[model samples]
Target: MTEYGRQPVERQLPTEEARDLIALVRELADREIRPHTAEEEAAGHFPRPLFTLLSESGLLGLPYPEEFGGGEQPYEVYLQVLEELAAARLTVGLGVSVHTLACHALANFGTKEQRAEHLPAMLGGGLLGAYCLSEPASGSDAASLRTRAERDGDTWTVNGTKAWITHGGVADFYTLIARTGADGPRGITAFLVPGDAAGLSAAAPERKMGMNGSPTAQLHFDGVRISDDRRLGDEGQGFTVALSALDAGRLGIAACAIGVAQAALDEALAYTAERRQFGRPISDFQGLRFMLADMATQIEAGRALYLEAARRRDNGLAYSKQAAMAKLFCTDAAMRITTDAVQLLGGYGYTVDFPVERLMREAKVLQIVEGTNQIQRMVIGRHLVGPESR
Candidate 1:
């Protein structure tokens, strides 16, 4: 259960069905997910079995159409469920979001035949997915990507190095973007590639300061071949598809950020009350009490902001700007709250004995992934003043 579990969130759910859905998710999360988070993360393990359980429980495809084996929940409900999962374990919550992003292209733009053949299994059949957009040199400057996909009548041979890919070696499939023509965004094309395809391999995962439970690595595609039938959307339109998926994905990151902050707050509150200081509980101190209040307030504010953005998305409105804002603010808040939790605990927070130390390390990555916080500001600025012609 999340900090949302500690104190119930008064949600504006559209139906009783949604309310019951969230309750069940929380019960399962508390009973099954949180128990292993600390032990598994410390061992730097990826819990593939946990993801299989999530898929089996119908949690993997919550925000998509029910016709494709999804639950068809709206963004608000999906995101809240994400918050609970992240509060239980960040690896699982973010993994689900990436899976949803990986499925976006075919579900939204694939031909009817493609959907019927693949969407059901991809969404709920325990298959994991990876979205490949950021390369070693083309993360923020995405239009300048150098991966090439040469088409030959019936097949496309892909060659490139994709960097910073989560679920890199382990994912069942990849949603790949590679340059097909020209030199800019217009030339990029999206393709679905099988994980076991020849000439495709993942490098050793990057050794990171945190989030050890999730693997991140560089992928190499050396003339990996796929049928033209695997192409998603139209040639030269991959950038559009990527951007659309990211707009929704940013909301997921925002929700996950709030979940981390809420967890950190919960930890701090629990520790302060039970922790003895100067012959009494540390909660008796004025200074520590103020810190707790501020942490709680930041979490509430982040949750509200992200939910507002989610509502805009569920209404089918333009929400890229709001999504960017939420991602930036919520991630930054998570960093602050987690760090504060460590500080409030004094030396114990700095050691592996406390979960706050791990939470602090994990919070650092949210600012960097899905697009850096700097990129979020650029997106928001462009929306406010219109993009400058280049």
Candidate 2:
């Protein structure tokens, strides 16, 4: 059996500090994450303790400000870290991405007092978070969500269901988006709701084809009340907050997609080099060699595309189009690359004995989450041609 996992990826990091960080991540993944990934994922277990370790290591909040216990790294460096983690285990990488998304509204738009009070623990104090925007009836059309938050004196009473929440029952806090005024985008508002708050509960986790170690479920807020201070951004500004977070979140997904693809390619290369056919290594075949070359090229292109978008975000440039393109292309590439890896392995790839089968399943969800590839294309199209006519 091939001992399959991450291979050393030559990276173009900007600083020695960033290089050290990547080294630490690789060491941690090899020791703690990669060894148990197949077993834990098969058992459908969430690695809560590993997240606490990541928080303590200051790996959870790399892109946020240092004052609030974040590492204060640029997106360019932070995204590369995510790729390394995803290469080891998608559960940990994507969980960190979702937690960062949960923090975006408050980190970027909340008052100083809010940041001072909550950001520290949320960032590096080992608290996990969830972002709640989609609902049973409103997935792609997030602005049309029906979750309502009605104000009563100094408190707001929230009632509705949030679907497909990543951290769901396991989160310490939730960044919730609910309707506060009229219909459509303008009426929406964002709130920081405690996961253990009264009337807040999670449904059983969804049965997923992959990433079983990460729970995805629906959360119910039936008369959940929160103080007005927990509101993020101005009233009627929730949609803007959600969109900004998503633009950044899309880049995280793109990096993760490349990581999965890289892992698949590594597996394929290792298997082909060792498995002999007709008294020679199967990798000696010209047809297989060409397939390996194409896989490598696609992975490289996807990495470059996402890194460019990350650089744009770091420079404060408009990157929604690039982010969408990266998310779309990288995820599509991951699916194709993993499928090819399966083919390269022949019968072994179809079996759970190899990691490629699981990698393929995990890659499928990346295209669907953080806005489906179709939604990504729509976002890219709107950027180029403007919104459709009414």
Candidate 3:
């Protein structure tokens, strides 16, 4: 009844190794992450030490190539591990997803020299990362970003502010995108900027409704400079790189949503069983029981949807449409499920004494990040038909 990911999920793992990996993740989550989540979250502490532990345990770089200090696990297997971690704490799960997204450009499009020089440290060297795309005015319309990077001989000078950056002030590196040509998507180029570089600064973190343990703030690049060798992919290809990274990042968000929903349900189940109602467990009530059934059904469905998309991605199939669908449905389901958990627990769920309240708050950001649910629907609609008329 108190298990993390043991929700009777029918996993079609490709190998014994994958199954073992999931077991190890579950153990790590329960022992290392879950026990301290509530207290640290209450204090708004980021638990950087636990991240170091995750890196040391090889959990930080599971989905990339082995040559780059990664575990080389398939997306399907990697997402399942994410589900387990998210069930323990979203700060850890979502943080890992952002870090992986930050590394995507270099890993997929960087030169061999760039990969050999940076991948080892980024993957397992206990370095944290942040993705910079959204800005003060360009969030959903990420292509409209105005941050500019002007090249000067062998170096590039950057100046602009990026808003809503995760791990903002604390990240070891930033995967930055700034306009380098005419306005629009094609004008952008990607660069890997060291966090401590001159003139790189982060504003104070935003006061959020949830995920208080994680930082969300703006990054300012005031004449920050980097060599051309730090550029990722071709100039004017930054938007393409960003979109490609998002396709995989959407799946990661979907998995994390399911994990949050599952945790909410777990909390509801424990509370309903122990706190007797009318001389018996509230779990015996027909209405409450049916709600639990619905929650479980949604979690299972979301899990399957993300895994299906992940499998398509792993096999090199075109999975953008499915990924959009998964992100849309899974996050919507999580919002509904967590809200239901709060209602099922009645009063305690709304109080800090229980975990459901925090879960409900955390479930919300999942719907908004990695591309909002509305954006996901737009992606699905365009895939189904075609781009809408202006």
Candidate 4:
């Protein structure tokens, strides 16, 4: 009686609950996100209202526990919502994904008291959250980060700068990674730092090549103070928490990648249908058709990769390698698909008039953020080498 009827199930569509949620999310995207995307980008304004809508509609809490007003959906279902959002607007998709990432430590490892105190505002608000891990010098090598967290009786004084923070200046809270001891990853600790902390200040927003509306900036932690209760886990466990959070975050980026690719492909298809050349439509041209075919192929494959990774995560399997694979392949596929979509548009693609150029710019960041593609390969390489190799 379901849509899969008689045909071999390639992948199961969403359950009734998930399908209903998707319908709601899609309607929101069509009405709110898509309409103002261009205007928001042009004016450098983020869609705070859309985020409020998502919170009000219960989309922001999709993968969290329902006791805290979350939807308690599986990652597989939650990611589909992300993909749909990304297709309409990368900024919105990325913002929601980053908010999810920011909430990861609290959701996964926070004390019961911490979850009770923070998860409500984090999941139920118009306030966006940010994950602060990257520093100017310690991007790929997060373990080597130098931000200091010195113990002061019952409180910790955090000092140093956090760079390349998404939602840097605007986030309501930051899940910050700071060093609590001497050298390497084991010494780092995670803290739920309030954005308005007295000494926590942000530099001017970074002038980015894309996702400009999302607001990346450098944050200065000048003797910021927090109670020991704010520490996410045991002292010296921040790096572990950060890495674990990224495994999930990678899937979010992968979904974003596929969304960007799908958007590019859709744009190409529509343009080719309307764009005339050689006495007919460009869609009719064999060469262009082949290019479009290749683009579609990459997107399909990327989608499969990300969904598989999501499934693995949902099943509680060791999915770090698969996640890295999905992030690497999907972001790479997005770069290619978006680039080709531009080519399919010819000269118009290079300009801001069309969205493919923005998609292309957005695709590059997926490769760098969450975990760099180079780092992803390193993870995969270690997996191939086996644990005994160490």
Please name the candidate that would achieve the greatest lDDT relative to the true structure: 2
Question: How many backbone clashes does every candidate have?
Answer: 0, 0, 0, 0
lDDT tens per residue, model 2, 20-44: 9999999999999999889999999
- Shift in Å, residue 345, candidate 1: 0.8
Ten-residue stretch with the least lDDT total in model 3: 1-10
Every model's TM-score: 0.96, 0.99, 0.97, 0.95
| Candidate 3 lDDT, 189-234, residue by residue in tens | 9999999999999999999999999999999999999999999999
- Clashing pairs for predicted structure model 4, backbone only: none
Whichever of 1 and 4 has more TM-score, that candidate is 1
Residue runs of model 3 more than 4 Å from their true location after superposition = 1-10
> Which pairs in model 1 have colliding backbones?
none
Q: Which residue pairs in candidate 2 collide? A: none
Specify the highest-TM-score model's number: 2
Candidates ranked, most accurate by TM-score first:
2, 3, 1, 4
Task: List where candidate 2 sits over 4 angstroms from the true fold.
Answer: none
lDDT of 1 by residue, 1-390 (tens): 222235555667888989998898888888888888888888889999988988988898898788989999989999999998998899988999899889999888888888888888888999999999999999989889998999999999999999999999999999998999999899999988999999999999999998899999999999999999999999999999889989999999999999888888888888888889689999999999999999988888888899899999889999999999999999999999999999998998988887898899999999999999999999999988999789
